[model samples]
Target: MNAEHGTPASAEPGTLRPGGRTARVRAAVLDAAGDALAEQGFAHLDLADVARRAEVGRTTVYRRWGTVTGLVADLLTDMAESSLPRSETGSLLGDLTANARLVQRTLADPRQGALFRAVIAAATCEPRTAEALHRFYDVRVREWAPCVRQAVDRGEAPAGTDAHEVIRAVSAPLYYRLLTTAEPLDPAAADRAAAATAAATRAGAYVRPSPAP
Candidate 1:
């Protein structure tokens, strides 16, 4: 799902990546699956339904994905691989602001927002989906954690700061609003998230304590 290359990241077990016809089939099936999940949530996701939407054979979907959970897991992997790379703005606030805005815009999009909501709700009860969701956020966190490291190197944040935590902080409030309230995922909210994270990070809020000898 790389935005520029459309190339998927490494396959995990049931996730397939065969070339030519197989790849096209995979893409079509996943796209159809995402559409179905977004439109009707996971409870309504069926292999036959996905097959009809994808125009691929039902056997192919069954053989490749096996179950709804497997398909959803693969979809989450594709989303992680396709997400945009982090911005390098040479400062902690600028970098986090960029990150926050990206999350805001994505959650604010109608289809993407609904898709995310469906996936998140599914994760709450489905163990496989929850693991997939965790991995998805892990990929995204790793992608942006370096910006916090850079901030530390530039003296913008203290040494021993947990870069992953700082990156998570910038997106937490945005996600909270997306799930909890009717408020719009506006740019102003994104900016506030970034600013607050930057301030807290500078105050050593995310710093890890030294390990005991």
Candidate 2:
């Protein structure tokens, strides 16, 4: 299990999100990879091409990430590391609204939206890619899950509320809209998603069930 945190960094890239020459190389490679994915999808991604685009040596790219799955996995790791921290808005609704807005903004951005679609498509056929994608979401969910727990503590949500489920629900609709219809992911749509999820959570629809004997 190439866990998000413990995976040994190859000698070239010094640390996660650190600043220096190695970090610049990493940033360049990831930016190039993203551009390729957004423009041509995962099927066309190549390490040599990414190296060329990043203006780094092909040997470095090959040495750092041995395969496409490894590179894509690293890209997802970087994304999770760089994502904004969860907002603490004092209420479940406010917090969920903030979460939805962030999702909406990401999906509405042409590059990021296309990049997500490309990775999702790749994940369907690639086992390693799917694992990486799941890990990426897990990181994001954990980030926002604390807010739901805070809601329970504040009495804005019922006891035994499943924090992760509530967080997922808030973002699900926005991602669905982005992937399904050719609809514009506007602020109104984000607000609706937040409202719906917050309402369901308050109604105890997301309460955790006891284990069966």
The prediction achieving the highest lDDT against the true structure is 1
lDDT of 2 by residue, 93-160 (tens): 99999999999999999999999999999999999889889999999999999999999999989999
- In order of listing, the candidates' clash counts read 1, 0
Residue 188, candidate 1: alpha-carbon lDDT:
99
lDDT of 1 by residue, 24-96 (tens): 8888988998899889998999999999999988887776677899999999999999999999999999999
List the candidate 2 regions with Cα displacement exceeding 4 Å: 1-19
> How does candidate 2 fare on TM-score?
0.91
- Model 1 residue 177 lDDT score: 97
RMSD of each: 5.0, 4.1
Off by over 4 Å in 1: 1-13
Candidate 1: residue 45 lDDT (0-100): 90
After TM-score superposition, the amount by which residue 31's alpha carbon in candidate 2 deviates from its true location, in angstroms, is 0.8
